[model samples]
Target: MSLMPDRKTIMLVLKDVTQENQYKREKLEQERKFIEQTRMAQMGEMISMIAHQWRQPLSSISATSMNMMIKIQLGEYNLETKEGRDECENSFVGQLEKIEIYTQNLTTTINDFRNFYKPNKLPVLTSLKSVVEKSLKIIEGSLHNDNINIIYDYNFNEKIELYDSELMQVVLNIFKNAQDNFKEKGIEKPLIKITTKERSLIICDNGGGIPEEIMKNIFDPYFSTKDEKNGTGLGLYMSKTIVEDHHKGSLHVDNQEAVEGEGIGACFTIKLNLSSQSMEG
Candidate 1:
């Protein structure tokens, strides 16, 4: 007979397998929840867009109907009054046409929303520049409010192929978090230096530096410094997930060189794979 394993050995092996499986299952569940939550938020934004699209059409319908009713009451709806009746008919028809255009806009918005909110989708190659612009727009108000200056150094010699939507989210999230942090610190003449090269992008902020002790732990999920009113702690975590897991990119951070009389800062570098068109690390 083959040598028999001890009961303790068997028990330890079973425990290890059980824990590994449980860890995987839990991670899968968290990913599921995260995707669902993001999709829901996007749906909310789309709903707002849908409403915005119909505003002009609905306004045109209401205004035209009121004016037509007024003309009828004033006995001005007669076709025999020279070209006056023809003019009124033409005006009403034009307003109705405006309404139809508005309605079509609303329908188009709904279609676009549906496409964006779909699941289990793979990304196609898109430009890095477009992602930068979209992220800048999202943080424009905050940047202005904080009096922080954004200087872009677009030195990329090659086009970066990326998933447009997800990369946009990653960049936007980083900018917003930096803006908020700097705003709280009351840093004057706050400067955000954005520099991009053929294979990497760097974002630096003059909002004082990240504490040395927490440097490595910054990427840990559910870890944040801001209070409940300010931070969800997921911004950086999600950013890492987007760049690393989704885009196969690499990201790292370091302390920015200090400027005399100005506070310290942190710089984040994101490296992209231009040749492979997808990050491997």
Candidate 2:
């Protein structure tokens, strides 16, 4: 209606545009920070997982070798004649078996990290139970230290058909969140339970439940109960994307349990398609 532009009108238009750009820049930065945070968190988780995976076998290897050395010192090993060859062979074979177990685990760890950190690909038939198992193994140390017991109620009948690495990331994210949440709340006995049947589900910690408002925004990017220094709010959001977009699955969180663990804290449910070969599942 007013074709003739006034100084106030021009100033207002410029202000609006500036504000819009600022908003976009902030959003972009938040997104970048979120991505960087995800990468860092993943790397940290992997490092810890590797250490945990290697810890037990390494300890066993050390102990076994020490035991063997002590036996040799006490003339427990017989190698004086040809008749002693069989005994020596048996003992060395046992040691070799232990070494083989350690090597096999090391190889599996390398492969798991490789698959996880590799570039994204389409979904395929992956063992869902195994994927989550690897993730749990990765964080076992932390779980033990926090007195957090993880209960895995799953049927290992069929391999879960989904994006293997993506599914793992989803599982890891939920587990880390559970552990962190429990620690933050200072709970004495933290418990995380994972169940997989028709759908893969994980439940953890029965302390403070998520608020109504936060529940609505749980899947929204940059929505976090943690402070800026602690959390970026992208973990769950990215998990949702990985499950829904990449893996053709779904991830959801409920504040209360449907049956048992009622009045408990948060529970996360993830549903994924069974691999083509998995007919019964």
Instruction: Look at candidate 2 and give me any clashing residue pairs.
Output: 161-275
* Stretches > 4 Å off in candidate 2: 1-37, 81-86, 127-131, 144-147, 153-161, 197-207, 223-230, 247-250, 257-263, 271-281
> Per-candidate RMSD vs. true structure?
8.0, 7.8
Error of 2 at 208 (Å): 3.8
Q: Largest lDDT belongs to which candidate? A: 2
Residues 170-213, model 2: lDDT tens digits: 88888888877878888656677777666565555575667777
lDDT of each: 0.68, 0.72
In angstroms, give how far residue 99 of model 2 lies from its true place: 2.2
Query: For model 1, how does the per-residue alpha-carbon lDDT over 86-179 read when each residue is reduced to its tens digit?
Result: 8877877886787677678666655644544443265655456556775564445446655778888877645555666667666765676677
Best by TM-score: 2
Instruction: Looking at model 1, report the run of 10 residues with the lowest lDDT sum.
Output: 7-16
Per model, how many backbone clashes are there? 0, 1
lDDT of 1: 0.68
